[model samples]
Target chain A: MENLIVEGSHGVYFVPYVNFNAETGECELAGESYLEDTVLFYNPLLEWLDNYINKKREAIKFNIKLTYFNTSSSRCLLDILNMLKDFEDEGGEVAVNWYYDEEDIDMQEEIEDYEIDTGLHINLIPSTDLVKHQEDDDDE
Target chain B: MEANNLEKKAQDTNKFDLFKYHSLFNQNVQISYKGPFDSKVLSVLGTYIQFTIGKNPKASKKIFNIFIELAQNIAHYSAEKNLFGVEEGVGSLVIAEYPEHYAFSTGNIVKNEDVIVIIEKIELINSLDREQLREYKRVQRNLPQREKGNANIGLIQVALTSANPLDIEVTLIDDKYSFFAITVKVDK
Candidate 1:
């Protein structure tokens, strides 16, 4: 399976960055995701995870560094996180790191909700580190 | 408080100033648009709102998120379709900035029969605290498609995001139609 790389854009609708590596099973969804068609945009990512879990059978490291996501996008994120939870439950090695704005109480609550709802342990990282990493990546 | 009086007068006289102007009320209206609530329109309007209120990051974030949900609510659920060729949710939206909080208001027509369920959803949201609202939203979002009904999780999300009760007004347009309006306030 080839890697999925989507360049996130901030036009009329914010599209989140998606990088799903077929080789390493390291995926990261970054930036804001307020899409025109929430399901249409996220369905492919879901399919990618499904394939990785079923076919690849490799450990997955998922990183979500989103500054903002609307409710529609939140539903899609829940779907993705639930998939990861299923994979973890099946004795698959899965680590999910969610990076959010530190000062955003709403985002913090949302992350907590996702954890309780999906029954998945997620590492909460502040976006301060994520920001420095982005800056470094930009320099490359 | 001269501007306050003018805004009250406008609201009392049912004369909401549309567009970028202080025609008959205060300059509280930061943004106003009335047209087809399609994806293109939503995107542009969302951007405009972001730009206009970008000064206050916290308030901007709350209002923007609420605006998107409410705008999409209008886009997806509004009964009136201004455009003929496509499925469009046509409605009106107004964002007013007061001293304390920013108010996001949107309205569209709905079928009279559905109004009861809509009110029930709002009342349910209004009845809950933050924790209960979160749980309710989770339960509703996790429901099967068949059991979901039209009471969308978006409404609950709107309530949670704004951290304020939904102010709803429904007017009977006719036997089959009623205008449903919702206003949510986000503190600045």
Candidate 2:
């Protein structure tokens, strides 16, 4: 499977950056997303994950670092999480980490809600300038 | 002749007073616009909110998100048309500032029959407290997209973001259309 790379744009609408690697099974979505057509934009990312799990059966690592996203995009994010959860249920290795602005309690709560909705443990990481932060910290 | 001249002056003064309230530069409103809800207009309004809110990132973020979510509602669902054959929707939006919070309001014409559904949605949103609203939003979000009744997800998000209940007012215009206004308060 080929890798997918999309450069995000911040114009009349915000588009989040997406990078899904087929070889490493590492997918990262970052930046702000308030799209003109949310589902249309997210369908490919969903498909990529579909192919990775159904065809390759590789271990998947999904990293999300969106600063902001509208409700529609939030639904799409749930779809991604649900897909990962299903894959893990079928004995596939999956990890989901969400990085958000520390000041945004709403966003932190949003990630928590996703965990409750999908029944999948999501790692919530606060945004910081310092690189190489430890992942074993508390999961607030 | 003098009496007639005085009456004419009175009429002119009344017209001037009406114009003052409708003026975009009216001091009562921090920002106001009446036109099509196009991308260009959305960008300008977004920047204006950011600039006006200044250093309060928290308020700025809430107001901006609320504005975008509601403005897009007008753009997508308003019964009125701007470009006619084109797909753009037309409406009016205003942001009024107060000591504690900014009131963001958007109004658009909708089919008279649709007013009840709109009111019911707003009422449902207003009836819920913060936690219930979050739960409602989660359930609604999980539903498949493109469902007709589920379009209020944007409104739900606005409530979640602003942490304020929606204040909605509907004014019947004619047999076919009514002006529906939804307002949200974003605290500074």
Candidate 3:
């Protein structure tokens, strides 16, 4: 399996950032997502996780840092989180982290809800730390 | 007879002005629009809401998120549509600024039969307090999304994001059609 990289867009419709590394088994989805066809956008990401779990069977670290997502996109997110929980259940090493704006009460509650719904220990980090790390990565 | 006709014309002009500037009654309305509701409309209004409301990013984002959900409801569920090749939701949206809160509202036409469902959804939302509303949203989120229309989670979202209870009103246009309006107020 090859790496899947999608640059997020902000236009007539918002698109979230997606970066899935086949070699390292590290995946990240960030930014806002409100697409014209949401299912079309998220299907491939779900497929990537399926391939990683069924084929690679390696340790996976998933990170989500979304500022806003519509209700439809939220469902797609639940699918991704549930897949991670399943992988964890199958003795696959999976770690999921969700970074949200500290000031955003709704996003914080949403992360908590995802944790409760999936029964996965999602590490909730503030966006400021995420940004700082990204800047450091760019510098390196 | 000429004087009577002049008086009638003057009265008509006054009525037109009153109708046109009805918003003047609440002069704090920061933004309002009446037209086809679509993705383009959301994008434009979303940007405006983000940038216009001072430096409070969280409040602006909340307003924007609430606006998107409500406006999308109109775009998807409104019985009235613009038939210019591709159909579009025909409705009106207004965002008013108060010292205590910002009120976002959308109104559109719906089939008389569908009004009951919408009212029930609003009533259910209004009944729940914040924590219950959150729980309700979680449960509904887990349910299967409808194949054709909204997953019926939009009102739940409005309830969660807004500072006050959801205000829903329906006016009968005729036996076949009715106008449905819902408002959400976000505190500053």
Candidate 4:
């Protein structure tokens, strides 16, 4: 399967950067994710994961470092996590490391909620650098 | 009732008195707009508010989160659709500052029949604490795709983001329509 790479945009709506490397089994989503059409924006990435898990049947490493996302996009994130969880439940090796802003209590709680909702063990990493990441988002 | 009182009081005093208790048009008003709350308008307002609502980053984030949900709520559900044939809803939004907090409010018209259900939902949301609300959101999120109700979930997110009770006002315009306004505050 071909890899998926999408350069995120910060125009009238924020779109998160996505990169799913099929060869290496490494995937990442970063940046703000508010979008005009959240499902449309995320469906392709979900399909890519679908293809990776089904066709390759290999180890998967997912990294998420979003600084902000609307509720609709949050639902899409859940969809991605649920897909990964399903893959892992069927004996596929999967690891997800999630980075959150240290100062954002609500974001940290949001990550915790994801763990509870999807029954996935997410490695939560707190970083002060997320503030800097948001700065880069603004520059875009 | 609140809207009617505000109108009567404004006409009586010949000034811009608001809500009969608090003045939303005071010098602390940061941003105010009345128009179609489509995606483009929300994007511009969201960016501006994200950058310049208040000095506190935490508070600003809360306000921005609440604003997006409320604005989009108006965009999707407001009864007033003034964009010709499109569904771009029309509404009013305001952000004002207080020494201890920042208040964000959105006002729009709605079907008179919906007022009771809306108020009941708001009260139910207000009754829950942070933990309960989080649980509510989780269950709502995990529901099967076909049965998910996004409109209620939007308001739940708003309440969760602000961590405050929603101050809602409903005024009967006639037999068919009513003005619905809701406000939330973020502590600075």
Question: How accurate locally, in lDDT, is each candidate?
Answer: 0.83, 0.83, 0.83, 0.85
Report the lDDT of model 2 for residue B125: 90
Tens digit per residue, CA lDDT, model 3, B1-188: 69778669869886554454674546888888888887777778887998887466767888888888888878877898887754778899888888878888889999999989888888988998888988898899888887634455877887888757888889999999999888888888
Candidate structures ordered by DockQ, highest first: 3, 4, 2, 1
Give TM-scores for every candidate, taking all chains together and pairing residue i with residue i: 0.87, 0.88, 0.90, 0.88
lDDT: worst 10-residue window of model 1 chain B:
B143-152
Candidate 3 regions exceeding 4 Å error are: A129-140, B1-25, B148-150
Encode model 1's per-residue lDDT on B38-149: one tens digit a residue: 7777877776777768888888888888888787777777889885766878898898999999999999999999999999979989999999999998887676532212
Task: For candidate 4, write residues A1-140 as lDDT tens digits.
Answer: 89898877777777778888999999989989877777778889988999989999999999998988888888889999999999999999999999888889999899999999999999999877853222234443
Using Cα atoms, each model's DockQ against the true complex is 0.42, 0.45, 0.61, 0.56
Docking category for candidate 4?
medium
Model 2 lDDT per residue over A42-107, tens place: 899999889989999989989988877887788888899999999999999999988888889888
Q: Which stretches of candidate 2 lie over 4 Å from their true place?
A: A129-140, B1-28, B83-85, B147-151
Candidate 2: global Cα-lDDT? 0.83
Interface RMSD of each: 3.1, 2.5, 1.5, 2.1
Cα deviation at A84, candidate 4, in Å, is 0.8
lDDT score, candidate 4: 0.85
Clashes of each: 0, 0, 0, 0
